[model samples]
Target: MSETNKDDRAALLAEAAGPATELPPGWLEVVSMDMDAQGVARKSDGKVVFIDGALPTEWVSANTHRKKNNWEAASLMAIHRESAQRVRPGCPHFGLHSGACGGCKMQHLHVGAQVAVKQRVLEDNLWHLGKVKAETILRPIEGPAWGYRYRARLSVRYVPKKGEVLVGFHERKSRYIADMQTCKILPPHVDAMLMPLRALIGGLQARDTCPQIELACGDTVTALVLRHLEPLSEGDLARLRAFAAEHGVQWWLQPKGPDTVHLLDADGAEQLAYGLPDFGITMPFKPTDFTQVNSHINRVLVTRALRLLDAGKAERVIDWFCGLGNFTLPIATQAREVLGIEGSEALVARSRENYEKNQAQRPVQQALAATSFVARNLFEMTPEMLVADGVADKWLVDPPREGAFALSKALADLHQARLGAEGAPPLPAGAAHWVPPQRIVYVSCNPATLARDAGLLVHQAGYRCVAAGVVNMFPHTAHVESMAVFERA
Candidate 1:
């Protein structure tokens, strides 16, 4: 090794082995990191310490703020040694300081390093929680590090004390909104509107009643949804119209739940939509619908997911928890038939509408395969329901944070029944001809729940984890989005 490299390594070792009396009282060497982006260390007695704003391989002094029997939560006080991956955060509102925005966590770490940590977290969750290891680790999917957030819900509060409206994310661990003027994570156009939005909200009579502003950006249009507890006066409505006209953005108002969201001026307002050009499909959705926050990554994700699924032209495919037919329609373009199932009838209807819209747009010579949508409470799935749905050649399971626990468990129960295990549920009548999908591609936003369902699939359902990898859907954040492919053994 070079003399300079040797000296640096020796310095780090010396710092780590320094006497307890020489360093700060709570000095500890961060050994690893957790899913929440906290640095993990242990006291001499083996008591675990979770320190915020610290990274693995860094030695920092921490102040314990919350303690339990087994672990203590602390904040970084001083760093005696720094990690090479540490970087200056681009956003002024991002930090551990008081009143900082809670929109992101890993901004201080290098973007590549952030993705690596998330990849490690996915691997650890799969092995430690599910005890299932993938046969191959796919390359991580990456996109732009900034200006990638096509969706965001900004909190608005009229802080009477400051005599101004506060608009942005909530303060870290605080209900009060952060005092941010601009955000780097949002699309550049949306980021430019942050201050203007505050001014616009501040000028309204319902400013105090208005609680949130949600942004959804498409290829050519940006839609903002304002959540107001009370009705807007005529003057306020006029002001909103003027602002929308001036900003080149459409305005949607929500007086109640997501179902009540509608455009302020529907006439001549462009429809909100995103396109997956790979499949020549454009999906129209309301701002309140559960669309992926990162549109660019979502497109790449869909492409990768469909590639991994490898549905044959003559094969049938099933999309569980399909919202707006994002995957179902794409699969329909390639497969013989596609069945989309979701819990909400409203979403199912929308999915069907999207399927028809795409079909109408397609050339007469190039028609999509048969596609259908159904609403069923996936959380209450059973072997009987599985038999009724019939078997598909492949499954695309993209569930919410809760994951497809019930669906996975049902499959496991069916396998047990096939084995004639004691106390196992008897096969539903006419299920003697039932068969499970040959392959399943699971897209997950929560790694823990994915691990749990993966355990059920691998250990109980007679399937093997073929390949898995992390998707950098939300960069500079602790959120780990992943996809795994499972094949029947």
Candidate 2:
């Protein structure tokens, strides 16, 4: 080879490799963790780098996968100094590798540290977004670390090229299904069914039609809702029945939307219900209804919320965004009158039925307090509507990820009106008689939204953020479920 030819080869190699400085030089110190469980570090140029599979206080190098002017997203390449809070991930399918499961993000971090990180996230969100701080930081509520997921939505895909069916969560940041044979977060029995489920679906005539399976486990019964686009044949139905019998699971089929969900065989199936033993309350729900994924944490959460709300026998309480009367009925056991409000009429109707069902089982001495269910779009609340609903002594607010913005805003409006603040909205017709609830216990799923609503309550509504804390509802995942207590000043 000539000298000129060698020089050309060297140039070609350099071009193929792109930039020699693709990876960040030296070790980066992870100072904190973002909401998604990614480690936050600063590069030499002062740009932020979000590194996956890295923990706080750890020195590491990362391989950049995405880059921008202000930040770079990278994966942990090497750990020069590992943090004591790091631990081996429990799940075989959890990793930064290709086709890893997206179900969990904090499996590598110690479970105790995971809860601490979530608490910091809540605190950061409150201070940064709401510009409010809680007077007291409540103790973090923790529960069973593993086998706690009582509900899951497993995606099903038939791969003709592989001649197999995949049943699991999506791959990390990809729509492709993860090749998961077992899951650590799921109940052992449910986890054991993964391989069998794949085999069952792969063998079915309607394998190509079935797209998803939603699992919901009650105290006495486990239900699986199968979503199928095409009609199943008699053979496929029999197979489902046989599988249900073998696994002691109930099968619910959904031909289209959630409304179309029905039991495959209702004659001998156990009623799906979870019991709040402390309150002696049993909640019966359909497979499609919105129920907590972690039953244990939910029961504890309800108990803690009621304890914090402290609705007395003489006081009237309202449960906002109440679905299935989870809190209203329990509150009715103590309060003079309790109202359960929800946006969906169907949910309100079901909540009424649940109230009736619970009443039938109660003894004469243990009778429930007066309770009523009403359908209302809480997101469109106004001060006038608040006055019309009458005054409640206490409230239990458990909104979804959107949080209770309008309700908070309504209270803020009423406060400003009473103060005669400039530019405040006009008071409603019955504003004089409308006394705001003395206390509110808010259950939130999103910290950012919670902080926004908290701002309205603390700064504008003349309420003190008494206490707040994190609820480890979904362990191993980056989800942050929390609760906050506010009291009128």
Candidate 3:
């Protein structure tokens, strides 16, 4: 081809590929952390750059791997100056090093500083997103930083070329599974099983068919649910049974979806349970059920939430989004009557079963007899539905990441309806009269949605943000669990 034609072709290719700006050279000082926990810095020309493995107030050199019009995504190459909060990561598999695991993010940060950053994240979300502030900032609830994770979904891969089976979390920024020998976040006993588990899988006839393993740990028992893409051979089954006996763990198998999970030793399976010794309650749950990852922090969180609720003996409390009666049973111990409401009928049934199991093992106390569970579509709750339930003296809401938007809106709507017109007459006889609870304790896993709901409660429902605090349920990760207390103004 001619030189002119070659030049024209190169220009065409460049245009089609979009902007190919080269990464700016030299080091940059990280100014702050973004919402996703990535360190934020700026290029010489003022374009924002996000760097992983870099902390705020640290000078680092990074290479721009992904470039956009206004920002770039980079990976830390070298650190010139590190922040005081920086510390050696507890897990050897942490950071951007080769064969690093992606299970944890903030392990390099001091444990105390991690909580402070989380508190700041919560406060910032409340003020910026909700336009509300708490009257008091409750001290952060913390627990054992390591060996606290009671649940995990570990990836499984059998690589014939590598001549081994890898069983653990995925590699950082990659789909490949990390070859982890031990995990620091898991319980010590469970962590010790990592290498053995890899060997067990390698020995299985259907090792290539197993894609993942789900771990759930209770107070007395640990269960492992293996996800098999294909049918397991009889030999594979025997191997699993042998491994379970050797490791003292219950083995479950999942052939398809979560609903298809079943115990291998159904007749001899031990009950998986967790205890709330403070409330004299024990909760039994299935391996696939949703439960808190950190039992220690969960207990502390429950205690704090109950304290903030301050339910009296004569008060009737309602627990919203009550899954397996975690908070309901505890509150039932103090309140006159506790009503637990959940969106899933299965969960409601499980809650009732748990309540009965706990009651059967203990004395017939007044609080135990007054507890009840109901199934309701919480996301679709309206003011009318809430009013029909009568007035609750106190409320405990533990909602998922979507937050309690509908519930908060319903309360706001009820408040507005009660106000009505200035000269409005009394309602007709027998009409359902709604009353707001004196206090509400909200547990949230997502700050954005919590702030949104908090705004409604404070501005529209005539409630004040009395106090709010963070719960470090997952210490080394960016998952911010929190609780807030709202009181009638």
Candidate 4:
């Protein structure tokens, strides 16, 4: 854990789980990286082993821990030959214990090496999960390495004996909060405010009452949503308001779950807003609204996506999983028309609101004439629903961790049927002449889903993954964020 009593950490761990495992003689060679960023190897007894805190291209001796029939897991014991890419981590707290802040992984690897590993992870997943190969590999998109996180949810816990309250991310491999003074991933301002936040929390009698603080920073506002397990007392309310005023921060309160998140001082004229200045669109959202944390890379990504898609005046486009119109509103400024589809009705309404807000101030003659949004159950989507939504000339999909498997499959069926000469074409008049969107841009948060959906798009849908690349949205951790471009055959 990040916070250690230092008296008996090893002893406590031993008491809890008794010396996880023993290291076998003869060092095993690490062949590859598994789903959890662990190095994979095997022992002579046919037991596969995974070593935590180990990377690819490096051979390390490890202590075996968890075991299964096909695979056994291990922790790094000794490095026989370390990769040249290994570098000192930027954050001091980045290791098994003192450095263990469950927030980031792969920090020990060089930044360039990190990107390369992410690309490899994406390629491996696509080939293994989807059995599809990209015709071209686009250069990985990159951005600032530090102070990029604009969305965060910090865990709050109090320790009366120490007369302190810890506020930061969770501990490595555990639910406890990491005792950290600052976070490198957060925006510069938020990172600077960490210790002050801890102090604020420590001062409150309701220190234990408040369990979380969700953060979202926009161009105009930095909203803090406090998640409290119990109701805040008048004293706690005053303390929070004082903290907010002192820090120039907007405060929100959640007495219970997410549904209870509300502005604590709304009349103070606070609105959280993120913007795509290139598209001349500013997106206003509640702190709870789902948006990518890395704004610098998001800008790069959207620009790259539009360039690859080549959305233009002659074509209309659809933005699937268009949460809060992040990509939809931007795409609208380039394409002739745009249809944004989302999973939540509230988000759909927000998208429409954002569209109108941007349209009124649209630059250069309102590049796109009209744009709209609809809420649909994308995972359970059917061909009929695809037809109902109106198939556009091109597609831009930015799904959640769950990729667009159902929608891609449904589109494939409709496209094939339309070409089969006996089935009805999807959407619009002169259905027979309707051709499926010629190109599709898929933005994915999870490589597995991307690979699975790519399989359906390539093998089942008569499309080929023309180009795919990785984007390190969350730089520290093993989580891989990627994008792929598919073209119809």
Q: How many residue pairs clash in each candidate?
A: 0, 0, 0, 7
lDDT of each: 0.89, 0.90, 0.86, 0.80
Overall local distance difference test of candidate 2: 0.90
C-alpha lDDT of residue 33 in model 2: 81
Name the best candidate (by lDDT): 2
**Model 3 stretches with alpha carbons more than 4 Å out:** 1-26, 43-47, 365-369, 421-432
Q: Write the per-residue lDDT of candidate 1 for residues 1-489, one digit (tens) a residue.
A: 233433333333334443323345668888767777888777765566778999988989999997765567799999999999999999999999989999999998999999889988898778767999999999999999999999998999999889899999998878889999999999998899899888999999999999999999988889999999999999999999998888899999999999899999888888899999999999999888889999989999999999999998999999999988989989998899999999999899999889888899899877999999999999999888998998799999999999999999999999999999889988898789989999999999988789899999999999999999999999998999999999999
How does residue 89 of candidate 1 score in lDDT?
Answer: 98
lDDT of 4 by residue, 197-241 (tens): 999988877788888898988886888998888787899899999
Writing each residue's lDDT as its tens digit, candidate 2 over 1-489 gives 233432332333334332333235667888778777888777655566778999998889889987765567789999988999999899999999999999999999999999999999899789867998999999989999999999999999999999999999999989999999999999999999999999999999999999999999999899999999999999999999999989999999999999999999988678999999889999999988889999999999999999999999999999999999888888988889998899999999999999999999999888889899889999999999898889999999999999999999999999999999999988989798789999999999999899999999999999999999999999999999999999999
- What TM-score do all the candidates reach, one by one? 0.94, 0.94, 0.91, 0.90
Q: Between prediction 1 and prediction 2, which has the larger lDDT? A: 2
Of 3 and 4, the candidate ranking higher by TM-score: 3
Which tens-of-lDDT digit does each residue in 277-343 have in candidate 3?
8899999999998899999998998889998998888999999999999999989888889999999
Evaluated at residue 353, the lDDT of candidate 4 is 88
lDDT of 4: 0.80
